[model samples]
Target: MTTVPQPLTLRAWRGRRVLALLCAVAFLDFVDASITNVALPHIMSDLGFSVQSLQWVPSAYLLTYGGFMLLGGRLADLLGRRDVLLAGTVLLGLSSLAGGLATNTGLFVAARLVQGLGAALMLPAALSTLTTSFTTSKDRHSALGVWAAVAGLASAVGILLGGVLTEGLGWRWVMFVNPIACVLVIPAVLALLPRDLPAARTARFDLLGSVVVTGGTLLLVYALIKAPDQGWGATRTWLELAGAAVLLGSFVLIERSARDPILPLNIFRVPGLAAANLTGLIGFAGMLSMFYFLTLYMQTVLGYSAIAAGAAYLPLTVGVGIGAGIGAKLLTKVGSRAVICTGALVAAAGLFLLSQVPVDGGYLGHILPGLLLVAFGVGPVFVGVTSAANAGVGPSRAGLAAAILNSSQQIGGALGLAIFSAVGAARTHHLLATGGSASIATTSGLGYALGAGAAVTVAAALVALATVNTREGESPMNKPERVLIVGRSPSVLVDAVDILRADGYTANATNQFDRVLDDYDVTDLDVLVFGGMVPADIKEQLRAKVDALNPQVTFVQGLGGIAGLIAAQVRAATSQETQDGVSYDEEKREVRLTLDTPATVTVEAWWGTSFTPPEPKSASMRVFDGQLDAGSHAVPLPEEVPAVASFVAVTVDSATQVFTVGAMPTAVTQLAPASANDNRLPEVGQVTT
Candidate 1:
């Protein structure tokens, strides 16, 4: 027999510890990406680099990070996730150290490239670990919330920290800080994570496909990065774009024929996968453009220092945290489609507000409110998109799913920055040529660019509304049945909850009955189950309180073990039958009747109907029992009876009753008595004479 694994409870110490570690790793990735932005000027001056060459410091990282992500994800699946994660962490730390100590531009750029590679390997592995470790939907949702919160806030935090570190300890410290932090993180990752399962030796590595895809992605990203500097219509830009297209097209052809493709083409067939990725792409594009334009506006137009400008983003970070929390809760209540659409619209509204900022605008009047709105709006979108992308994916493909999402964000950010920057620069140049001041021209350009970003965000919202599935991860067998299980042992509680959930019920188990009573509204529950270990008095008190609140709620008692409890709950839930003088034998395919005197009986079978209320119409069958001397009678059902028939109802004299077999319900009504000769099969859909 196969056994289901129990999910970790959010309240447990181990669960909290794992979530903290995962969030910390995610935080490091974002912080490292943005921290260097503030230190760019210092690095250029210290390394004696030209302005044009200095751009490579950030660009090199983006290239390697975006290019290698899919391959890294494939490695995680072919090898072990733990192995890939540890290797990446160590590499990230060493690269940070090398970057800090570099004496020349060449070495600095090389270190940045290595850092990007390390991040590519680390991110997807870490996400896969989190998704697999948190088995229950509730815990996974909470874990992803923390992950999303860290992702949303870390960029802002990085800017602030970079400014403080660069000013106090010099630019080198900005590079050195990540390695120092990794000293603490490396040991925790090793100690906290479980041992990896053996690698899948049978899985073939698709080296050719990997090379083709990586080259294609790198060329595409390079084109986008250089498009603003080089005229978009320039020959070099067009050639590179055309080359990227050819390479990507070849990758598709190669994957279709590869024995084991790095990215299986079939993964896209998963419901909502493509839609979610598209939403992420467009959404991230708008968000990244907003950050880039706003940062420039604060420093160049408003004359704010790096530290002051970074500090201004604190409100946005807090708003994102709030939105993540709300979105996580709403995922269970309303599903991903509604939450994502709502979030995208909110973000668009925020961007529209920011587009109206003037050169002389204060932080309070123009920046803060707009930042808050954008942060909150994007927060829910991140959560919804992440959930939609990963839903229903198997463990083997978990890393691939994470990698795709990360790549979407990275590529979207790069592309959005390129496109919006060009638009803003062109407008700025036009105004400058017409004799406008630098400040007015820059402000006007940025406003127009932001308006374009807002339009893109609105488009993302429409895409989400139209394509994201409403009932993600839901199974037909699992209706939304809310159940509460009270127990004394944690092990037993976890087991019972898993079993009930597997059977399609929404189950919550708690060892602390008192705490549960205080925390949850038990009256809203459909079923209440008491484990054998639960104290009788405590169970009675809780049950009495719940019954008073909702008298219709079913209560199951006297269950001894996890299996027993699950069985009892299922039986109680399906046992809604009202029988008088008739009974149906499911296995024997027969109906029996008991009578006190000579009386006519009518039997009917209702097929293909739901047991739940608001039942639909079903095909019915009727049989007549001629007036007969009393005691017991057996009526064998015809073999032609539909296999989908769910209930058999018998009417005796003037009485009627309803009963259900499996998921179908049956109802019987009083009928006139008929002679035994009337036992012939009635025409389909015709009333018996």
Candidate 2:
């Protein structure tokens, strides 16, 4: 007999604290990645390094961090996540100690590479641990939510914490602090993580795949780094770029044929994964560059203290947390596609706002708007992307999906920073050659950098718009009962199924859209409401399909947006026949008139209260009323029309007639006979804004 797997017991499952520990570990990993930024000045001064060499500090770290991400992700799967986590933590501590106590530039750069490797390992392993621990869909989603929140906020918090540590205790502490954090968390992690063994799968390591991908990543990063120093056309730059192309091409080919792929080609077929990954790449590319440029601006140009700069970024961090929380709450209701696309577009808008920041711009006007917009844009994106990537993933492969997503962010950020820095530096050089002031050139360069970032974000928007395929704002099961009526409020139609289910109409109400199509035998679907539907091609197609399948089905065009129809009513009430109502402002010498008709009409102004109507009026209004004037004769209304200070409302009434005038003050078109009956006007209801 096969032994049944033991189910989780309540007391033995310390999953909650294990999750918390992983989050903290991920936070520490990112902290070391960016912490040196705030301490760059002190480092440069202590080492007596040139600006050129100083730049390498960031570049070297970014290069290795991005280059090794895929490899690290693969390692997480091959080795047990628990073992990788412990090893990574030890590597982090040792690297921190070495980096903090470095005496020479060579020693320092070597230590940074070590730190990047440690971070690369810790990040994927931490993510794998969190993802693998959750078994059920609901639990997995919840776990991802917390995981994404921590991941999103880590960079911002890293800088802030780095700033405080660097300021209070000196630059060495920035590097030293993580080891302390790691030591504090490791024991708790050891206790809380489950002791379950990893499955002994026969998957082999993809060394060829790793080498090609890593080589490509390194070459791409090398091209970026070199482009800033060497001209873009430089032989070294072209060689590196060409090498990157070849390596990446090879990587793709190998992955397809590999028995055990490092990067699975099949995950791209998942509905949400491809879209989410695409958007995440674009977002990280644009956003990470902004941080690099902004950091330079704040410290080098604005001369902000390290601590002060960190404090200034707090608003953005807080906004991101709040935005993510709000997005998480709304995802179940709004659906994934709408939220992700919207988030990408919103992020592009934020980048646009940020690009407008001038050399002398104020923080309140230029920076704050951009910061808030970026925060709001990024928040939903984090949650939506995380959810989408892992939406249908099995427990065994969830870690792989998470790794791909994480790698996208890391690689995108690295590439974005490198490209934008080159742009900024190039622009600065161009301005300086023209004899511009150093400060002016610096700011102008920042503008170009940010502009490039905005452009990449726009590309991201296009990706999101094109590739994100999930339906927006749909309930899971739309129809649950048979013989249902649809000629009611859309919400009411939705509610009917729920009510009927409670009343035992059928097998319970459903919100799944596809189930509605399948179970009802489209021919048997008794009713449909047209007016409640949005004027969308998808809805139209669905309607056509149902109509074609079941021609006998009844359809009811339940009126929707009645208030808009009434607003159309108010617009139609302003046309005049012969004598047009006009208001004049003597001080401004302006006169305007409104006319009544559904047809487009134009109004002519002659700087007088009364003037002959032009054959073709420049402006016109619409009126949905009982009737329009019978002929071309102007009929004045007794009621005082709602008039703007310089405009007057006009009304005409008859059984039914419409008249148009031309530029020569002659009638353009007129109905020969009026309709026999008038449409009665309904009583006005309260208007909603």
Candidate 3:
């Protein structure tokens, strides 16, 4: 009886406490950002701040939060997410406590700045934690769904919570709440979350590049926030922006020569990563500012009390929950583009509607409808872009990707708010000079600003439409992953085609490595399976060409069990069931090679009991090519390496060949020669061995 091959099995994280701890961090991020917005007036009054300085209250927090976020993300990746997360949690708690007890404006602003830093550290670490913890697609989708829902709800609900706390207990409770939550959550995080994993980056962290990038980001955010008040045409504004640009440009140069860069520029090449980050930058620029304007409209124009104004967002909060829940589930089904486009357009429509709220606007007719629409649309867009940014990313770079997305969003939000706030102020002044009422001028300014937001959101939709690929991800249950099988043996290829087709994949087979591109289009292909019989040089050449055609397609080194074993490896690559770099199968005495880049890999296996001193009882070495980019490849042991090898090590691009390995074992079947005078195909023995 023939046995079916077993694929790599992915185990989902079952630690609910770990998930909760991570979610708390996410919850804290949104709460900290949004809660302060509502309490700004109270803070200004209590801290004895002047009108111009009042803006600094929130700016202090936002400037640091947006600026340091990228550094925080890289820190999580370098130091380990668990450890970084704990550090950020502690910092945030302490900063919040300091803010709560601050006696003066300067002290409070200092506390807020540190609080922003803490938040910057926590957000990416928390997101990377959730992503790395969940190994399976379904589980990750569910977890991210829950995380997004909580964050979405927190954005609108923070305003309400701030209003309640500020009104009932005083504005100081807003600052106190963070520390209290952190104190309660710290024990759980320590008990549930795993410790920091050791890092592979041998060289020290890229300090020069990090410092330059952080300074650049901080300057850029500060300039954007200052641009409106200073006037867009101001010389100082231009100089600050230019300086920031220069610093950021220099950072790229520094990274190119750094032993290990904090941000590897190559990471942007990952499909959907750049598109998603750009989309977030544009989409969120409009979305976050809407919150600011709406709150201003309620308190400054409509004469509503803090609690009443806060209560009005209840519908928006509910809508966000519903939309995010549905969006997370629909992600792999409709793909990122469709979801992002749909959400952006819906949000645009909602923004346009909001732009029409008149001086006499009421809650239901003027505000609630628009708020609900924006909430629903914003929810899906947030979830979609987040997923797209992270799609197909390995565990090593998860934090970096998350941080990039957050940085884009933060920069966009800050820039958007500054621009809109300035435009509104300009319009309000224009109207007042033209003899309009204070209420009418204020309403007119807000309307025009919102209209501008609508236009920006439409642009975001266009970007998503142009950039995001709908066909290249792991979802769409209706269409199974497409795979192409390449090997020397006709029977093996035929068997692979039949077996994979039966296994519900769209599978194809070819015996020619040289003719792969001429015969097949690999752009939409997911996994490429190669038989051991294909020469190492030919495999490497084929991969280099295939990468140019479609770098996303994973190369899998396969072994015995025909279609069954090959199919399992394919499943593992697409689903991220196994580790990123390499895997080992003891029964088959083979190693699975996974690489993010093309490089020579020397695979060695050693066998020994306790009786050896300078040498192992048995050892085998196989040198694999100029480059092979793939999910996994078999490091099949020839007759030279016995099956009892105790350890296996893979070194990339090493000059040492060490020991020579033996030839292929005898085959069960062999291919026929090209002519009667010719010998059997060079790889026929290896094919069926």
Cα displacement (angstroms), candidate 1, residue 582, comes to: 29
The lDDT values for all models are 0.73, 0.59, 0.72
Residue-wise C-alpha lDDT for candidate 2, range 338-413, written one tens digit per residue: 6666776777677778766777777788888887887777777777777766554433344566667777887788
lDDT of 2 at 376: 79
Ranking by TM-score: 3, 1, 2
* Candidate 3 lDDT by residue in tens digits, 1-689: 11111111124244565666777788998878888777888888888988888888788888999899998988887787778888888999999999999989999999989999998998998898776666445556666767877888888888999999989999999999999999987787787766644221224778898899999999999999899889989999999999999999999898766656888876775667898889999999988889888888888899988888788889988998888888777875876688888888898889999999999899989998888889889888877887778775554567887889899999999999988888888999999999999999999899888988989998998888754543234532333356887777554464455345433366676776776787677888888887756778988988888888888888987542233334444554454322346656666655566665565554543322222322212212322323555445566655544543233444444222222122323231122111100111112112111
Which numbered prediction scores highest in lDDT against the true structure?
Answer: 1
Candidate 3 matches the true fold with a TM-score of 0.71
| CA deviation > 4 Å runs, candidate 1 | 1-6, 198-201, 467-473, 479-689
Error of 2 at 513 (Å): 41
Q: So what's the TM-score on candidate 2?
A: 0.65
Tens digits of lDDT, candidate 1, 1-689: 11122245578998889889888888888788778776778899989889888878878888888888887877886687888888888898999999999999999999999998998998888888787667567777878878888888887788888878877888898789889878988899888876554222223578888999999998998899899899899999999999999999999988777656787776786678888988899988888678768988998999888778778888888899999889888887788888899999999999999989998999999988888999999888888888888776655567888889889888988888888888888999999999999999999999888888888899888888655453435553334357777665443454455345434466666666667667567777788777655677897888788999989788876233333234334443544442365777667666667777777565655443232323222233554445545777777666445554344545555444444444321221111111111113343232122
Q: What TM value does model 1 have?
A: 0.70
Predicted model with the maximum TM-score: 3
Superposed model 3: Cα runs more than 4 Å off: 1-13, 198-200, 466-689
